[model samples]
Target: MILKINDLSVRLGGSHILQGVAFDVAETGVTALLGRNGVGKTTTLRAVLGEVPATGEVLFDGRPALGRATHRLVRDGLGYVPEDRCVFAGLTVAENLRLAVRVPSPDFDLVFDLFPELRQRAGQRAGTLSGGQQQMVAIARVLLNPNRLLLVDEPTKGLAPAVVTAVAAVLERVATRVPILLVEQNLAVVRRLATDAVVLEAGRTAWRGRAADLLSDADATRSLLGVGTTAGRH
Candidate 1:
């Protein structure tokens, strides 16, 4: 396992948002974090990165990862792509990607290869770009770093159908280079990219198995996610 969370629990603002959330991420391929909205899927990722106060054991690369600072975790080879696609609005595309270069990597060519438009729009302000372009920058930024695993939260959120397709293509190429712990609601992307899955329900591990099994079972999908087929796009 590349990542492990044991008996992880978190309370924020007097609410127990996550309780005993536990799962394992393999060393390669995407592991989808599936759950309905507000079920603490996002919070679970936050806890692993130590962005929130939590009680539990988190192991990264077989080392105790809890209580570590976020930057240290990244330096240790963890990458994060927030759901909101937090690109530097005022910065140009090249500048935004440049900021993420914590260490020199060959990924500059790799990222641009996956997202050629990023190279084309290298001079454009990020805020002025479309949602899809910003997401590309967000994912590409992390790839530029010396990262072993990527924690991606909803790369398809709010994107148009065409944009989702494009992002999925980029992510497919990216997974060939590093493992991905993906938090995505789009079932189509999950089915195509995820080899394993950890389903979250009410902030707990409701189900865990191969992505193929979970996705093929309709009842389980409806019961846990309250929506069938994360499949989208026209």
Candidate 2:
């Protein structure tokens, strides 16, 4: 396992957001974190990166990872592409990616190869880019560095069908290199990219199994995710 969580819990504003959420992320491929809205899917990813206070056993590469600062975790080879493609609005495309370079020699080749448009629009202001373009910058920034695992939240949210397909293609290529802990609502994208699946219900882990098995069972999909297998299909 590249990442492991045991008995993970988080409380925010005096409410329990995650209650003993636990799962393992394999060293390769995408692990889909599936759940309905408000089930702490994003919170779980935030907790793992130490963006929110959490109590539990979190092991990253077999080392204790809990309580570490977010930047330290990033420096330790954990990459994150947050929800909503949080790009710097004032910065240009190249500048946004430049800010993410941590190593002496950043992997520009890989990032440019994955997102050729990012290179083409290097001088364009990120705020002026379309939603999908901004998302590309968000993902491209993270790919500039080497990472053991990537915590990607809602990569396809609010994107057009064509844009979603494009993003998924980039993610599929990226996953071949680094393991990804993905929080996605789009079942079609999940079916395409995820090898393993973990479902969260009411802030706790409800199911963990092969992605194919979970998606293939309509009853299980409806029960846990509050949607049918066809939900969010492009």
Candidate 3:
């Protein structure tokens, strides 16, 4: 395993946000962290990166990663792409990528391979790009940083279907190099990208198993995910 969370709990503003959330992520595949909104999916990612105060055993490569600063985590081969596409508006795409360039990893070309449009718009200011393009910049910037483990929170949020497909493809290619823990609400994207899943409900893990098993078992999906008539309805 590349990442492990055991008996992790986090409280924010006097409310318990993570109730003993636990999961494991391997080095060669994608693990989807699925849940409805306000169920601690984002909070869990933040807690893992030490962005929020929490008590947990977050082991990365068997070393303690909990309570470590975000920059330290980045330095130790962990990359985080937040739900909000946080590209520096004033900087050009190439500048943003250059800012994250680190040593000992010459995989910058691979990012271009995954996101070819970014290479074409390398000279454009990040803020001028469309939402989809900005997202690519945000993800690509981290790849330039040369991290091994990726924590991606909601890459498909608010994207058009075509754009979402493009981003998913990029993620799949990126997964070939590093493990991913993806927090996603889109069941279709989750089905396509995840090898395994951990379903969260009200800050606790509700179900843990292979994605295929969960998808095949409709009762498990409806029970654990609380899928009602509203789900997948147009």
Candidate 4:
């Protein structure tokens, strides 16, 4: 397993966000974390990364990961692309990527190859780019380094149909190199990339199985995700 979460729980301002959530990510391919709105899907990802105070066992490559600082965890090969696509508005695309280089030699070749538009707009400020282009910068920032696993949240949220397909293709290519723990609501994108699936409900894991199996069961998909198997762009 690339990552493991056992009995993970989180609380903020006296409100429990996650209650004993448990799941595992294989060392290869994509694992989709699915849930409806406000069900702690994003919180689960944050807790694993130590962004919030959490109590539980998070094992990265079978080693205890809790209690470590977020930066330390990131330095230890945990890459994250947040939902908001938090690019520095004032910085150019090239400068945004440069800031993410952790190792002596960043994988510029791979990043440029995956997102050629980023190279073309190297001098363009990230804020001026379209939402999809900004998302590309966010994903490319993490790809600049070598990571054992990636935690990507809502990569396709609010993206156009064409851009969503483009983003999914980039992720599919990236997954061939590193495993990803993805928190996504877009079932179509999920169908295209995810091999394993973990569904969360009200802050706890509700189901775990093959992605194909979950989607094929329309009843389970509707009950848990609040959407039919055909939901989202297809």
Residues 140-176, model 1: lDDT tens digits: 8888887778999999999998998899988988888
- Candidate 4 off by > 4 Å: none
Per-residue accuracy of model 2 over 1-234 as CA lDDT, tens digit each? 999999999999999999999999999999999998999999999999999999999999998899889899999899999997889999999999998899999999999899988889999999999999999999999989989999999999999989999999999999999999999989999999999999999999999989999999999999998888777454
Clashes of each: 1, 0, 0, 0
Which is the better candidate, 1 or 4, if ranked by lDDT?
A: 4
Once fitted onto the true fold, the runs of candidate 2 whose alpha carbons sit more than 4 angstroms away are: 232-234
TM-score result, candidate 2: 0.98
TM-score of 4: 0.98
The better-scoring model by lDDT among 1 and 2 is 2
* TM-score, one value per model: 0.96, 0.98, 0.94, 0.98
Model 4, span 133-176: residue lDDT tens: 99999999999999999999999999999999999999999999
Cα error, residue 12 of model 3, in Å, equals 0.6
Residue 142 in candidate 3, Cα distance off native in Å: 1.1
- Can you give the lDDT of residue 176 in candidate 2? 98
Over the stretch 190-214, how does candidate 3's per-residue lDDT look in tens digits? Answer: 7788999999988989988898777
Superposed Cα RMSD, model 3: 2.0
Clash-forming residue pairs, model 1: 187-230
